[model samples]
Target: MEAATRMSGYRRHFSDADNEFEEENEAEEEYLDDPGNSSTSIDHVSSGAVINSITSKSSQSKKQSSIQQNSNQTLIKEALLRGQKLATNSREHARLTKSVTYWLAKDSQPEYAIEKPGFKRMLKAFAPRYELPGRNYFSRTAIPTLFSETYDKLKRTFSSTEVSFFSATTDLWTSCAKDPFLSYTVHYITPEWQLRSACLCTHYIVEDHTGENLKESLLEILDEWGLDAEKQVAITTDSGSNIKLACRLLRWTRLSCFGHNLDLAISKGLRDYSIEEVLQVCRQVIAKFSQSWKKTRDLAKSQAENDLPAHKLKTDCTTRWGSTYDMIARISEQQRSICVVLATD
Candidate 1:
């Protein structure tokens, strides 16, 4: 390719002045022997060749530049048309809309596409004619439709006869809003012998927590997904009396969640007086920065000045295993920056 490029340049030189090819070669030889004398000598040999070379290069450059401009303009027009197509609400556009909703859901970005003006502007810049759906459209229509489709797909996927047995895991927890919810997940082995897991459902359980109610909910979910009740392996949950009673009522094998048990063990170990004091100190230190925007900004500034990663402090959750380890590790990594910030404050 390099040799070809050199040959192409040579061709451009010769195409300009056919008479100067011989004189140009002679000038090259003189230039190699005595570079000082060759500049004056070459000017006499073929000034026309030099002039022709410059004219050909400039003309080629202009043509290339013009071609690039036209190509860019064509691309811009095509992209604009594509953006318009996305807005037209055709099947393709619906698919894109569905995909965007899925992205938002997967990333826990509830209304980024709808409520974020910068995001909307980016879409508009690409296609000015297309209109973006409002947040209400996503909340009221798009998300529900997507959920139904995904549920259907999950049902179909798990209904395969190749899956002989499935183990279920259920957790009932209260959200920040103090709403009680039950989450169900299923684990199974494919015919290929690969283990897989999927969240089956999460829904409000407004009724009082009872064994019979839990059993009924579990059976309904299994029947909806076409899972065989007889082929149930085990139901895993925290060692709660209600969950145990539910499993016994359904006649499903019961297994205490290993993760929950481990967390309990770790929590007990961390209850040592020395560990408690240290954790208390760590929490207060992180709380000072994390609870206020100004302190967080100052910490970030300190990190930047100290040539350290601007990682924020993580507050550990009491019920979550390994969270303390993570929080402590981050604090250790950012210790110098934390010191700098403290010193300044």
Candidate 2:
């Protein structure tokens, strides 16, 4: 009987635990099903808050990133502007102007070239913010300043004791406009044994090219440079009567230009009947090719095929016999190409 009572007690305990578990589950299901429940509403509000927090953080991060990018761009733009301003300042401007003047004088280009639209465009492409000077500035101010500085420096060099005696070479030539000019170049040895040469003057001759006129002009140049007349060892000049007479009047040792004499000798020798005939035929052939663009192109093609230099045919100058020799030599060098092109014609 006691054992049966113990079993009944155990059954009662398990039946009570099962009833409690079913009651808790029914309460949880009721809470989930009810839309108006406070606990469910609180959970929905918490989830929405988490989503809003994430969205706000993301937006703020993107905004900061955009602001940082804009700041970087602004800094770069400011740095560029500062650099451009520094480059175009007065000091740099003057330096660049001097460089431009030097380039123009060295290349023998006209001052007006800087003012051309194409040249200005090129400068803009190189340095967009830097402004180039006008032609008037280069021609008047920059060029004269450069000349004065160079003249002073050269005068100082000539006055130095390192250069004691110098030999001079002078020549007179007429420009295409019929304006005559005289040029004098001086050569000297430095104390270090370096042979140096410089053109002292190229003055325009308003008067005739008489011996007296040339002598006076030369003396004036020598005096202006503070060059001692006694220190001048010799002067080399062509075989012109007036120049020789001027050198004689100066009483300085005069030397005939060897190149000019050689040219003269070669020219005299080339006057032979057989050589003249040959040169005339060569001239005719050169002229024929020069006159026709088609033949010139064909000659270039033939030269490539023959593995020869792609040099154009040279025309001899009437005054320079060396050029005549050069013309004949060039013809000889390209003989195969010339023959091939002529055959095509």
Candidate 3:
């Protein structure tokens, strides 16, 4: 009921795509405070015969008290559950969203939950406020609780061996999602020899990607994460000048991303040769295949009839600018196909 009214109010007042978001939020609160319902709930005082009124009033009081107690308990339970979910989800969202949405519009007017920018700001509110929950909705499980939960899970997960200081790596990138300005990641090599790269932090210093900006960003990350560059024996990177500058800023010995370099070398060599011209043809061919649903089905049918191999592009979502080895791994995994594309007459 509240949501329905809120939506109606939003439709009435929501001004423009960019401008009306915050205004819609004001309507939500108004809708939730339904004026008719407030009066209806308060007006019925039950004026009747003396005995009838006394008994009816007593029964009503008892019923209301019981309802209130149950409501309070329900509120408590819901709050705690929401808080627990918030803690877990907040961390997960931070890591995931940092890649795409880095900067937030602060101090802006609030909008309805459904409004895009309003929804974004609401989520960002959870970004900095994951400390502890003391409200009636959920039990308090802030940083201490979160860390304890993590440590326990880790201890049991690696019961066979003792864990030590983890080897770490960091990287910076502008996500194609383009929502976030900058993303910084840190990798932790565990005792079991598995590599895990998690977002340490993401910053929105500004729009331009420059050498000075890269150096400052890198320094900020290390400082915020309390990492000592001297202890980080080696860092890795692709051929990006900004990334190289970042490594230099950190004073870590740079490990060239060999796998990436090789792939890039192939790409560059192809561009310098006739490969660039051929790629335009390949792109047109792909468009022919993808132009319409009918075209896609027809292409599939023709390929099946002609016994031509279905081509697939290789993807390496995990490959980082510093991951030379990862670049090589990806290239080698599909070397035959890539070679055919590159060396085609």
Which candidate has the highest TM-score of all? 2
Task: State how far residue 185 of model 3 sits from its true place (Å).
Answer: 3.7
By summed lDDT, which 10 consecutive residues of candidate 1 come out lowest? 80-89
In candidate 3, which residue ranges exceed 4 Å CA deviation? 1-168, 187-197, 304-345
- Could you tell me the TM-score of candidate 1? 0.65
Winner on TM-score (1 vs 2): 2
Candidate 3 TM-score over all chains jointly: 0.41
> Could you give candidate 2's per-residue lDDT for residues 30-86 as a string of tens digits?
887887897777889899999999999999999999999999999999778757743
- Against the correct fold, how does model 2 do in TM-score? 0.74
Ranking by lDDT: 2, 1, 3
lDDT of each: 0.83, 0.90, 0.54
The top-ranked prediction according to lDDT is 2
Off by over 4 Å in 1: 1-89, 126-141, 288-309, 334-345
RMSD of each: 13.5, 13.3, 28.9
